[model samples]
Target: MRNVGVREISRRTGFSPATVSNALNNKRGVNKDTAETIRRMAKELGYERSEHLDHIRFVLARKTGKILDEGTFHPGVIEGVERVAAQLKLQTTFTTIELSNREAAAKQAFEITHDMSNGIVLLGTEMAEEDYVLFRDPQAPLVVVDGWSDRLFFESVVTQNENSAFRAVTYLAEHGHRQIGYIAGDYRIKNFPLRERGYRRAMREAGLTIDSKWRVVVGTTVNTSYDAMKEWLSANPPLPTAFFVENDIMALGCMRAMTEQGIRIPEDVSVVGFDDLPYASVCNPPLTTARIPNREMGEIATHRLMDQIREPRDYTCVTHLSTTFVERQSVKFLQS
Candidate 1:
């Protein structure tokens, strides 16, 4: 008899692979009929429960619990973390960091230290290294997501920011764009600072001068992006042929400002953005951006935390996820 694979099962049952996997694992969210069909296929394939799988299942069950809350970063990370935590028999809790006050955010994190469960995950763009150290201890295991701090000595998961930013800008430069402009977000955080460094490095490697009027560093909001772009455009008589935006949110604002003044993308101004957020593909001309593996990174972070908590190992690891350049309608190829 042929072995039943996830894809084969999905094709046969007309259900998604995720649904089939859920049913096979006895996870919630799949209907009874779907579950039965999945089991039947498994049985037909002579699938037998292995001891390793059972122990793995037991650990997973123990790891996932009631609620696993996360802060600041997108909830998509929480979903992946929860799934992995559930596999380990624990749940995840999510909360938002108060951006207005660092002390308030720190207090909230300290409060979570007293939760029913000991495991914690924190995600924040503005979280400092010192704040992370307070949350991390030998007894209580914590994972820092998307931020890097030298003061806090703990395991972390970071998005591949520098390389991704370099790729986006280099793509423009390679395609005959020398007089390039940059719309950057707040440089207070480590990642953005690294990205800024990457941008400067790219510009220097191409033998291009860094003009003050071409760089805009401001808050990570749409309004900030709009105002920054507007200021740059007004101050400079002629705009660059291409521009690189820090994030999708700001990219939207930059596009708005450009369009309002009758500037066209790829025609009058070529544009590329980081973070292929949900709205990136649906924008006016679609956004050419970098895609981050948010969910997978979250899942890996959870699993790493669980291992540290359970095994009490001496291995301290830092994981960096790579980003992909997604070609879309936003960028215009200028043949110069």
Candidate 2:
């Protein structure tokens, strides 16, 4: 059997040399049907794709320190991405870009990634609306992970924030808690507003009165949340029987403050958190929270990027992965 070259494949498939090259190497810019046809013809003609086809770039548009945080959700997601890439025989290069200035960040990101790989997986949690526009017409196929932008259309994989928050609040209501409070995260993050909306909707549905004074907005980190909660608790405001926190880190911080003030968990005030992070299970009383499938979200995002690479198209829909409710000792069942 004779070895086939891209020229031969292109000649036989009646496609341009560039199109054949993109299709055979699994790069974007070719239509799905055409790419499939080229692959089939190339195989029939005994063509072997080059090793460069296996290259991919993972771009994290956040503070490098935050992405490297061992206790956060990003580590699990990165692990999942690496696992899937290995399974697919794809080589991945990880990089981080500071997103403080959208214009400068976009330019830097594009300069770093323009010709480096066949596709890109962008961790867009820190990216703003303008920052995403730079990648909208990317040189290679791109998939945004862990965030969504309403101003642009692109393939995205995000957690079911609204649905997960709804379930957590509903769970609290089912346990005979009518005054449900919310511990909100920074509204700047795209998912926080959705989670807050879900919390409000669930409270309304359960016929619970939402006391504005009980709702508190805190920073995204454990220390910040602890300080904020401590300050809020000093006011001696009427506390809700249960609180649904935006994430496990903040929930644990709030719990710490409550403990410091001699307030008991579940016995006095029940707490539920979103994103069942690793520490959630080992916290003082073990948190009752909604489990965001961080790893699975990463895996799905990688697969979606692969799909876009194989067939370049205008993909507009955002994919949302469902979250599971994790029952733990932190939340108590009140007498109806």
TM-score of each: 0.72, 0.81
lDDT of 2 by residue, 1-336 (tens): 454666577789899766876776677889999999999997888765322345667787874332234347777778778888899898878877777666777666655444424567788776667677666545456678887778877788898989889989998998899888889865356777889999999988998899998889886678877888998889877788999998887888889988998889989899999888888999989999988888887788788877765665645569888998999999989976
Whole-model Cα lDDT of every candidate shown, in order: 0.67, 0.78
Model 1 alpha-carbon drift over 4 Å, by segment: 1-73, 97-108, 114-116
Candidate 2 lands at a TM-score of 0.81
Worst 10 residues of 1 by lDDT: 54-63
User: Model 2, residue 7: what's the lDDT?
Assistant: 59
